[model samples]
Target: KKVELVTQGEATELDKSLVEKITDPLTHLVRNSCDHGIEMPADRIAKGKPETGTITLVASHQGGSIVIEVRDDGRGLNREKLIKKAREKGIDAPDTMTDAEVWNLIFAPG
Candidate 1:
């Protein structure tokens, strides 16, 4: 039910620093998720979901750190494609790693 012009990060009483650090990165991440991460209407329909898939961005305080999660029910990360692409770039990834770890590896410096 919240609405605003800028659509930037929100802040709780203890979130001043967190709000600053996450605002720009969060904006870019949301833009990327909407533009590239989520599938198109036809793709969603083919995958057995509704035409418009929902993207949820949540922020909360978890102990000493703030936790933010950007999630969508659309297609998750494609592990095989990522591994193949990484291997093409000569990055060695251990097979014992999980998809979540592999996803972070995509953000690592090459």
Candidate 2:
């Protein structure tokens, strides 16, 4: 039996058209997470963490807006390479911004 571990909003609130379009993209993201994000069994053992890594999906309503989150205890964003790439692309990423802001540069188009 499948059980919903947690949810805080109406899952049906999603726009039907957009939902249908994004379903495959969402599935691909989850599958990619399983394949590339989560470490292998042997690697986890070597790292001294649990053999099986965990991926969590969260949904909620906040300030009258829906929120969806997919998270994992895996390798996180690479900041150094991101900043270097930004410079290479001629993006003037001021040093005042935080690491999180620098990381967002990766999403910016060339």
Candidate 3:
């Protein structure tokens, strides 16, 4: 399968220490995009998307901090799976909550 990587603000440089600190986490995020965030080739074709899924990394300086975002044009985080996992783990989330709230459950402590 083909995966397209789009990088924004590539010219923005950060402190070496900060770059080192974020490297592993950033790599993991990219891996997740390839492994889970993007659906299979067959699925993408069925959905009328190009066979190649795009993973976009955008960076911008906001105030004193640099904001780096890793995003993908793919299936995205599965809402239903997240909600089900929350329920199974006994996380206190209700269906009436907004989709964003449900999505945030992925970050909650067990």
lDDT of each: 0.68, 0.69, 0.88
The residue pairs in collision within model 2 are none
lDDT of 3 by residue, 1-110 (tens): 67999999988889999999999989988998898888888899999998889999998898988999999988877778888889889887677878889878867877
TM-score of each: 0.72, 0.65, 0.89
| TM-score, structure 1 vs. true | 0.72
Model 1 poorest 10 in a row by lDDT: 1-10
Count backbone overlaps in model 1.
0
Question: Which candidate should be chosen as best, given TM-score against the real structure?
Answer: 3
Positional deviation of residue 23's Cα in model 3 after best superposition, in angstroms:
0.8
lDDT of 2 by residue, 23-101 (tens): 7866775665676677777777788867777767666667877677766666666677777788889998776769889
Candidate 3: segments with Cα more than 4 A from true spot: none
In TM-score terms, candidate 2 sits at: 0.65
Cα lDDT tens digits for candidate 1, 1-110: 11112222356344478669878987877666776667888887888877776667766667877677776665777787778778788888777779887887768666
Clashing pairs in 1: none
TM-score attained by model 3? 0.89
**Model 2: residues with Cα > 4 Å off, grouped in runs:** 1-13, 88-90, 93-97
